[model samples]
Target chain A: MTNQEDQFYITKILEGDSSYYTHLVNRYKNLVYSIVLRMLKNEDDAHEVAQDVFVKVYTSLASFKGDAKFSTWIYKIAYHKCLDALKKKKRNFDTVSIDATYEIGIDQVENGLGQLETAERKEIINKAILSLKEDYAAILTLYYFEELSLKEITKVVGGTLDNVKIKLYRGRKMLFGILKKQLDPETLAIYERGTK
Target chain B: MKEEQNKEMEALSKKLFKEVELQSPDSNFEFKVMEQISSLPIPGSMAKYKAPFSKWVIPITIITLIGSILLILLFGTGNQYDIMSKLPSFNFEAISSPLQRIPKTVIFAMLALAVLLFAQIPILKVTFKNRWH
Candidate 1:
């Protein structure tokens, strides 16, 4: 939905019409879940955090004065909730280790070699993203995954514009190093093709 | 590190990063959230609205307002002419009769009740609908 349509439904929802919020949810669910999933790295945790974020948005709609885009604000809420969940799990400020023990046989990749390649590449990128400090991961996710501009990212991450830029520069470098080390050459070639 | 080389590397990293696929959520995820929200007590109902703090404030405000009105009425009865000279007056012909005076108190009470009811409405709907279900 367009921002204007979203604002209209948000107004309706805030006016004690909770049913209309489902429209807002349906529109943004995939994007919001994607961000939370990246940050949390656990499907169950991501789902819980995303839901909490929306419920928070529903409750706090009265206070949203359109000072920033609704997407930026909602993302900020989701980002913070994911961070909070990580903290609660005692997993904050540390990289999530990918357990080799959880790896299945090649039959698990029976869907296709293409999917297998993509999954292997994703594991590397996910590892890289998780390896970065929370602050850097947050800005990177906001910028790359959510496609938020620097100004909006500053607002979402509660940092200055220069801080966001500095983090983005450093975060990308750190992620690249991790990716090159973790992904095999064929997987990297496949990734390059998919991007182009 | 050379600046141009760093920029090129950053661009390549960004390009490679874009290849990361989205992790699909489990099918029953929305149901999990819905269940959680459904379990929460809805806001602004009688039990919450009638908390001791709000209950105290409502009655005290009404009493204070009524007291102020009585004081004004008593003082006006005693020194109506003098006070009329000293104070900026709203024309009392707009309120022609003593019978008309009673409605002012009723109006104040109604206004107070309206404010309370308005405050209570959100809480009521939030709480009641869930209970009814």
Candidate 2:
């Protein structure tokens, strides 16, 4: 729904037609879920945290000020919830070493993925995205998947536009490195079985 | 040659990233979140007027108030009495007896309210600090 429609629903809900909030929950749940999922990387944890994000959004809806798009605001909430959960678990994104990477020759790196079915390739990319540092994964998700403007992402991620740009640039490179590693021949042969 | 390889990699990454759509959760995820939201007692701020006055209202109110004060200070000498006389007055004599009749229960309630307000002092301090800073 449009931001105008979001405002309408918000006003209606505030005016005591609380059911209109269902429209908002429906509109943003996936956007919330995907951001949380990419950061947390566990389906159950992601689902729980996604629910928390919506609850936080609903509870804080009155403070939303309309200074940003409703989507950006909700994304900011989801990002924070993920961060809080990670902090609580004392779990940092484990950055695998470049040596840990599966070093396929350059041709094999691109060509093996090229030969895969669309579904297999998508799985490869999804796995690669999840393999990056949590911050990088989140940046990539916001930029590439959610299609937020860099400024919007900076608001969500809390940094300067230059910081977001640098992260986005580095995030793409890291994602590529992960994808290159995962597309090695043995891994491709395994995925060719239509497994994992 | 390096530039050509970089261009090719950029193209491939773009194609792959674009293919990654925002993934949907389980079919019932929206219902699940709404269920939780529904369970939480709607906060007082969620009430209609607790919905903020239009953001413009604050600046406008301040400006109008300041303008009125300035108008009175500079040019309202003759009209000051008129504006003062125009203010609606309460018939407090009727209210005074009933107010005196308020029971010990209400006195206790007032004490409780005072305690609550005292409790809120730190919160108010933080709120003002954040607002001004």
* Candidate No. with top DockQ: 2
In the range A71-104, model 1's lDDT, one tens digit per residue, is 8888889878877887889875455333323332
Sorted into a CAPRI-style docking class, model 1 comes out as incorrect
- Interface RMSD over true interface Cα atoms for each candidate: 5.7, 5.2
Q: Is the docking of candidate 2 incorrect, acceptable, medium or high quality?
A: acceptable
Interface RMSD of 1: 5.7
Identify the runs in model 1 with alpha carbons over 4 angstroms from their true place.
A92-119, A185-196, B34-126, B129-133
Top TM-score model: 2
Count of backbone clashes for each model? 1, 0
Name the candidate that leads on lDDT. 2
Give residue A70's error in model 2 in angstroms. Answer: 0.9
Candidate 2 Cα outliers beyond 4 Å, as residue runs:
A97-108, A186-196, B1-10, B43-133
